[model samples]
Target: MYSSLRSLADDTFCLRLQRAARVWRKVSDEELSNLNLSEATTTPLWLINKLGEGLRQRTLAEHMGLEGQSLVRLLDQLESAGLVVRRDDPSDRRAKALYLTDAGRKLAEQAELVVRKIRARLLDGVPAEHLAIVDGVFDKIITAAID
Candidate 1:
């Protein structure tokens, strides 16, 4: 039985959103594992690749919505893994700039393809117009939550 929009939004929307996120992550992790990557592990590499090289560490943390120290730990692990490196920023010696190694760039590209495959599978039959509308709603919700 269909319910009122207000009721559904108030009671079910958040749950559905959370479930969708969980499912997306689960599928993404499983697929990425084929390349010896997991969502948590691939995220920083992918983000750096997407945003371009020499991104400031503080900027990366802000983009990731992570605290600086928390991001530092991840960066340490990535550096040790030889996927990323931190260089002293030319403009600010105390600030670190992040860059992906050749291996990291290659892995990031592969992870990107795998993510696209998972996204395509999940949105196989979704109408573009409906997706646009949903995206608009999501944008507003995100803005409201952040504000």
Candidate 2:
């Protein structure tokens, strides 16, 4: 039945996602080991590096699919390491905007290089033309998941 087929497909997709996530985590851990940063700290650093200044921690947390408490814990680590700082929002005293320190920016750039290299290695044998489709599929998957 179509319903069963759909369920099967969903399960397969989730399994593949988990596998890929595990691989990514392992690669990141190995690559970032020299920095003495944990996965939790690295996550916010990566997000802040991408979003830059003026982004709210809560909003960024939602975008990254993390719950509030988890995000707070991550932010605490990043703050303690002097990699990021939270400033009082001009419009809302209760809200805070995240900013990356110069040190954070330098580390983020290095981390990006590691990610790019790992991605390139993973896609090494794939045809160049297929990259567009691969990117499209990832976009579609993210959109669908969000929706």
Best by TM-score: 1
Off by over 4 Å in 1: 1-8
TM-score of 1: 0.87
Q: All candidates' lDDT scores?
A: 0.89, 0.81
Across 45-65, the per-residue lDDT of candidate 2 in tens digits comes to 887888778689888888778
Question: Residue 51's C-alpha lDDT in candidate 2?
Answer: 79
Using lDDT as the measure, the top candidate is 1
- Residues forming the 10-long window of minimal summed lDDT in candidate 1: 1-10
RMSD of 1: 2.7
TM-score per candidate, in order? Answer: 0.87, 0.80
As for model 2, its CA RMSD to the true structure in angstroms is 3.0
**Candidate 2 — which pairs collide?**
none
lDDT string for model 1 (63-130, tens) is 77788988998888888889999999999999999999999999999999999989899999999999
Q: How close is candidate 2 to the true structure, as a TM-score?
A: 0.80
